[model samples]
Target: MTIPPIVRQVVVGASASDAYAAWTRQIGTWWPLQRHSVYKQDTSVAFVDDQIVETSSTGETATWGTVISAEPPSSLTFTWHPGHGAERASTVTVDFVPIGADRTLVRLTHTGWEVFAEPLDAREEYRGGWVGVLANLRAALPPSSGGAEDVWLILEAAPGLAATGSVFAHPLFAEHLVFIDKLKADGVLVAAGPLPDEPGHGQTIIRVPASEAAGYIDAAHDDPAVAGDLLVLRVRPWHVMVPGV
Candidate 1:
């Protein structure tokens, strides 16, 4: 008997090109590292040497899949073999279809279930798994905007840490700047600068869809500086009264 492909789709508020890049190049940012890997203790996942490998905190790694096709801003197909060898692998294909200038429809199709020993059970497991994975992907995407309203996130140092002295002198300060530059390049950050006089306070204005406001906030908190306890963040929704052309 032939098995039907398991499929999932979601509308993301990002350009097709940006969406594709996030799905392929920046997967580690959005993927649920703890929940969707072969190893329960995995720390990170990456596309290395044409394979999707999950690495644990202790540096052990497992192959999730192998890349088969890569067409930027459009589609990608790869072998799937999480917790199993290539002999029992399946195929996963993701397509990015542009619906508007700032909107794209992302569709995921997982097929070849017959390769698995327990095809029915494996198929069911992935059905639920893909749902969560897609949700995380949606949240990780930079908020989509339509030139109407704008939102921004603010970061500040923890209470006592702010008084320590020049935050710019901190070792991670340079890395923090690099992270900010990355956000800027992704077109999510509008402007960011340190409030030198304020000691521990800084600001960043971003353009993201309101639906994804919470995710954007979470992303800010995930910043290396914030996650490393080098800084604390407070996010607020801001509206631009007069946006520059």
Candidate 2:
């Protein structure tokens, strides 16, 4: 009774290096710790000093796994055990394969289910869990694009007077949403989200020809939150770069 390894794959809209960096370096910013963590509280997880560590707001830390081997922009292998001890650790390997100049097919393989008391049940559980984990990864990375040739703009929004906890209830919040909706309707919006680590900060990506990007910047300033000083926003040019660049 040998259990097959659980394999999951997702295509990201970034170069191999960018995808690898997001998965390894920026994991703490995208991982859904609220739904999948050893602790019930909203903790942050990151790869630190060759180990995957999770830290809570109270400063308590948990060692989830150790890095076995890492090849930047290529593959990473690590042990997997969050709430469990090293004796129960499994093995997870992630491979980043470039499908194009700016697209990568990331494949994650989880093995060693035999270590569990009920290997079949554990495998089934992780099968569903990995789907959500990968979905987060997909959302974290930039959306798929043509290649390095494509141009994208990042609209960075930082809290101003609305930095407090009641930002959602702020009167200008509704107008801010309308601004976002207009971008979507114009078909320039790519993706948008609040920063996980930075409270009251957000970013939205829009695809635009380089020639027209300047015009979009002026349009984005019309956002009610920005105009009202509730939020500050700035546009930055972004493009996929090769590994060396």
Candidate 3:
């Protein structure tokens, strides 16, 4: 007897792009690795180089799956075989649908149960597991604060503990780059770079819902460079009288 795939859906309080980014790039921050990971303790998980990899604090690593397809703010499909080999892999697909200005419906479908020795039992176990997983994901996203007005913010960053020339070589720089990637994934990053002739002066531009500006500012504060004192950031609203005209 063939077993049907598991399907689950949840509504998240975020735009489609933000919801997708949280499910993908920000997964490590929300996934309950303490109980669900291969090591089950001090483990971190992420999608890196087209594979879902889990790493233990002690340097041990496990491959959960290989990404099959990824369309930002729409759908993502990947193989699944945590703590097992590729021969026993299944498939998981997640779709994001916008339902409102600040809301998205996320659907997850798990399939390929026929590959398991006991497809029925496996499906039952995962059906229950996905509930907790999706719940955790939904809770991690910001709550809906409906507003259509947008505001552009400029971030002026100056060197702190790290010298201007050495800032790029600092370990915190890697984390900063990851933060920038998250911004881009969330469709908020407009542009970022240093001034053409002004040494040690850099700026970043982001557009976000006016009411949620505080949340984005808090996110920027969490950036490694800012949090680690490698860089100091000052955010201010930008009035675009003539944008790219």
Candidate 4:
């Protein structure tokens, strides 16, 4: 069928802005690259929200797409490519819309496969590809804020302490939960939860004010669960916070 030469459609989903940013900015952290990657060797993953890269040693690089249209917490559109050596390329667009309380609609479609020299092969390559990647992406976007900004953490240990920090196994989820519990107790954290869904890795955020961030980091290191990699966190300052303003 030559893969119909194109894929076109819409996606709607509801999610927090932070969740959206996690998807675009930290894609490599979540994308199932090991299995779906097209590169033959030297597989590498890099993401800048505007771009998602999976490069191989044989020079067959796969660029997922670009952020052509993006509305934080609502929708995004980008193109897709299986390999740098491919004879053709395609586009993929995704949208997130709110359908209910703390819920979102995610619509997606990929188009322009006819441009590829091997339309059928390209189509075949992507038959269930979209399902897999999109499913991963969808799961990453959370239904609510979970008060990531207001969170604080303390760590006494980090599991599987490594020399190069390659393996990330540790009490990450448990630590964050403990941190959230502390915040809740202090009335600093409005809500909190694990984001292993969006980032496909252990991650969390707080919904506290900007001025309170310094102490939050300090207190995080004091925790008994996440102290080992205290130097790993790269804290950033947000301009402001609004629920729907």
* Model 4 weakest lDDT span, ten residues long: 154-163
Give the higher-lDDT candidate: 1 or 2: 2
lDDT of 4 by residue, 1-37 (tens): 3232222111213444544665666666657776777
Global lDDT for candidate 4? 0.49
Query: Which residue pairs collide in model 2, if any?
Result: none
Candidate 2 vs. true structure, TM-score: 0.59
Cα lDDT listed for each candidate: 0.71, 0.76, 0.78, 0.49
Clashes of each: 0, 0, 0, 35
Top TM-score prediction, candidate number: 2
Candidate 3 per-residue lDDT over residues 1-245, each given as its tens digit: 43445655665778889999998898999988776779998789998889999998999889999999999989999999999999999999998876435766677878899888988678778866876888788789755666677768777776653544567787887888898889899998999887767656588999887656656765776787876656666565677667772
Q: How well does candidate 2 score on lDDT at residue 146?
A: 39
lDDT of 1 by residue, 1-245 (tens): 65656655665779889999888778888999788886766488888878988888898888989999998889999999888888878999998876434756677878898898888788778867887898888877644544343444343344222225556777666767887887788788878886767756687777765555545555665566655445655443444567684
Candidate 2: stretches off by over 4 Å: 145-245
Q: How good is model 3 by TM-score? A: 0.59
- After the best TM-score superposition of candidate 2, give how far the Cα of residue 207 lies from its true spot, in angstroms: 26
Instruction: Order candidates by lDDT, high to low.
Output: 3, 2, 1, 4
Between 3 and 4, whose TM-score is larger? 3
